[model samples]
Target: MIRLAIAISVVIAVPAWADIAEPSGFRGEPYTAPVPSTLQGAKVIDAEMALTLWAEDAGFVDVYPRTLKPQGLPEGTIWQEPRHDTIPGAIWLWNTGYESLTAEEMQRLEDGLASMTRGNPDMPLVIFCRADCWMSWNAAKRAVDLGYRKVMWFPGGIDEWQDALGPDLVRAEPVAP
Candidate 1:
């Protein structure tokens, strides 16, 4: 009788299974999906699969964190060289990132997505940068909101890509040696 009672309690304690609550990355922040349910269908992929399948044909956008260059150092600030770059074929668009974007930034994001669509909502768009980065999540969600039928979120972004495919695979963007 005690064994059965314990089994029943354990079953009751188990949370009901559900689709990934946050289809975007699992970061609770200014960038969590406003309507997480709507993100139910967003495809999430890794760098290897992305490179093998959609790398060549998808509208890849790099949502990597832009290195914020500090102006006028206070003194003795340890400033390390920013290692920022996009995947070989990913488009680098500034201000298309951030969970809380200004009106103009949002506009640019929408415009860029629309330009990629070119009236075809079914165009597969892959957005990524770093693993678990909120920037990519917000951007991909914005794409889906813009009626992009094929929105893919590469959670394992450039970091994973370089780890899997090597540094030679990425392209040095706006700033690099």
Candidate 2:
């Protein structure tokens, strides 16, 4: 009787410890075609696809984290192309990735994007960051929310870019250093 009672208690206690939450809300959803999987309504693509699109004159954009409070970025923490050569016409938009951004900041980013694109909404814009980074995800979402329909997210980011394109393709060093 005691043994059964102890077993029951152990089983009851085990559930509390066993409840482990997933990180970054990663759902492991299978990749589907036609519409590109997204983090938050933003179209996401792989590095290979982005490269192909860029080669075809599709406008690509990089949404990166900012070290500075606003506008300016800290030294050594800016986004760069794998070959130090961006996708010809790619633009860099620094969005610090703070938990919350002010309305003014959002407007600034929108205005910058508008100016960069020359008011062309049809221009293709690709957003990227290191793999598994939620920063890019959030940035992409914000872009979509702002009515930028041509935005694309590069999920593989720098790591996959280097692995597939070789060392010569990697121009930007890791920021953690």
Candidate 3:
């Protein structure tokens, strides 16, 4: 009877589950979806707030995944990589937001953050991708994990930026570590 009672208590103590529950680690694929309202260690901001930060010269990072050219294609086939545009002065940190990353990939993110923040963990660094995208969420969480003191997550990413500002975004290339 005590065993059954303990089991019931455990079940009752469990929090209600939601489809968009924020996991302790990076979110998995189907990267576009609803995100949690808060990121524990970082500030979650909207487009207007992002603009304010931009005006303050905060470092912005675009974590939207880059499409890699397929391998084993016919030699005669032509391929063009997709172009990504971001907020002016925002650095593109391509492919660093995946749930799983190799050691080298993790190094890239660390190095990029270190460079952008000028080795100051307290610098205001904003990380983003697109509205409803978890890539930004993952990246922002990773930044917090890396000891960034002023990490801001612009969850409403480029979509919100374009709506709030204008179509004034510029093409960006990923920065080297």
Pick the TM-score winner. Answer: 3
What is the descending lDDT order?
3, 1, 2
Encode model 1's per-residue lDDT on 13-99: one tens digit a residue. 745343335644434365422223234457887767778645457787776556665899878888874766677766666557676
What RMSD does each model have against the real structure? 6.2, 9.7, 6.7
**lDDT by residue for model 3 over 1-177, one digit each (tens)?**
999999999987745333456797899888987888789899999988999999999999998888777999999998988899999988888888889887877888888888899999999999999998898899899999989999999988999999997449999887754
Candidate 2 structure quality by residue, lDDT tens digits, 1-177:
999999999877644225333235322222121222445555668877877776776655554554433445687766643343333355555542333566765665677567656788667767766666555565666667677778778866665666667234322322221
Q: Which candidate is the best by lDDT?
A: 3
Q: Between which residue pairs do clashes occur in model 1?
A: none
User: Candidate 2 overall Cα lDDT vs. reference?
Assistant: 0.56
Clashes of each: 0, 2, 0
Q: How close is candidate 3 to the true structure, as a TM-score?
A: 0.86
- TM-score rank, highest first? 3, 1, 2
Candidate 2 ranges beyond 4 A from true positions? 1-37, 69-89, 166-177
